[model samples]
Target: MKINFDKYHGCGNDFIIINNLSNTFPKDSENQIKKICNRRFGIGADGLILINYNDKFPFEMIYYNSDGKISTMCGNGGRCVMHYCYSNDIIDNKSEFLACDGIHHGIINDDYVKVSMSDVNGYEKYNDYLFLNTGSPHLVKFVDDVSSLDLINISRNIQKSNRFDNGVNVNLVSRKNDNLYEIRTYERGVEDETLSCGTGAVASALALNILSLINSKTVNLDTKGGLLTVDFNKSNSKYTDIHLSGKVKKVFTGILEL
Candidate 1:
């Protein structure tokens, strides 16, 4: 099979986006999906996204991890797929779509894309870390220096703990100011530190808000890949209208043979 794919990235969290409107792409071949996502031997990406037709929404977003498992909602993947939809005239600048988590709305302004994320209703706090789900589960920890920590080992140990089930995306956050933070994330499905993680950023920002570390409703995050901005509204211990925004761009387009 020869598949036409376009690569896109938001703050360096890359994905291979395919227009599967005709349902031509093979959805059951996990090994083939994994091979295509291989860094050394295939078209490298953190995940793959399929833009499929939907009855209620403009389209449907089906996402897979680098391991080729149909995974939970990916914030960066959502933004990149929105970009693809807009560029392909499938949708306008602002649109709503269905993802793995739920319905999400996105607005595109030039190179910037802002997607609404799922509302978080619960939190788990440990002495040194915090846990929350922002579309995907994340473990947030504060570190003096994010650049110096060994993410793989730390995340692996935490993933093994009874506190976490299966695995969790681990985020190391450093406070730059009341409204600014620096984050480095080890994503579970990717199984390593990614340059940036949209959901992880959202988890970290909301965690900081709950800790009263952030004074502003809009939080600015600096990740190793680039910058992301998260804005939200809090009322009576509930968070809503949460939006994640960042710059997304098309990296390239190619044909992959299987």
Candidate 2:
């Protein structure tokens, strides 16, 4: 069996997107997706996305980490899917799409996609760091030297710390200017430093704001791969109208012989 797939990226967070609406994939396609995502043996990618047809939503988003397990919501992945839908006329330039977290309203301004994220209600403060879950769990800490930090080595220590059994994405943040932050993230499922982590960026930006580290309309995030921005309104320690904006472009398209 051959499965047609398209590759896309949001701020360097790449994914293999398969049109699963028709259910044309085999019963074990999910497992096959894992193999394709393998960096050493197949088409390397950060993750995989499945766009399923749904009656309640314009489309359904199913996400998977490269490890072959179903994962939670992804910020960059969401934008990638939105762009994929628009580029392929899955919906339009603007539409309501369903994500793993919930309903996401988005608009495509050319290649840049800005998406409204879910509301965040929980915030935990530690000795020197702030933590939050904006669709995905993250730990954000202010750092002095992000570029020189051994993110892969140190992030692993905190990412699976006993405090979080399920695990958490760890982000090292530094205020660049205004509301902009330099961010390096250790993803939970990915378990390594990727070019970017969308939800991690959102969580870091919001946490930095809560800590009074930066104040601006848009939080410009600099990641190892590319740049992403998070815009939102804060009132009484809560966030509203949260939007995650970044780049999503097509890499290529091909069919997989299964």
Leading candidate by lDDT: 1
TM-scores for the candidates: 0.97, 0.95
* Candidate 1, 39-78: lDDT as tens digits: 9988999999999888899999998899988889999999
Tell me the lDDT of candidate 1: 0.91
Off by over 4 Å in 1: none
**Best prediction by TM-score:** 1
lDDT of the candidates, in the order given: 0.91, 0.85
Badly placed stretches (over 4 Å) of model 2 are 27-30
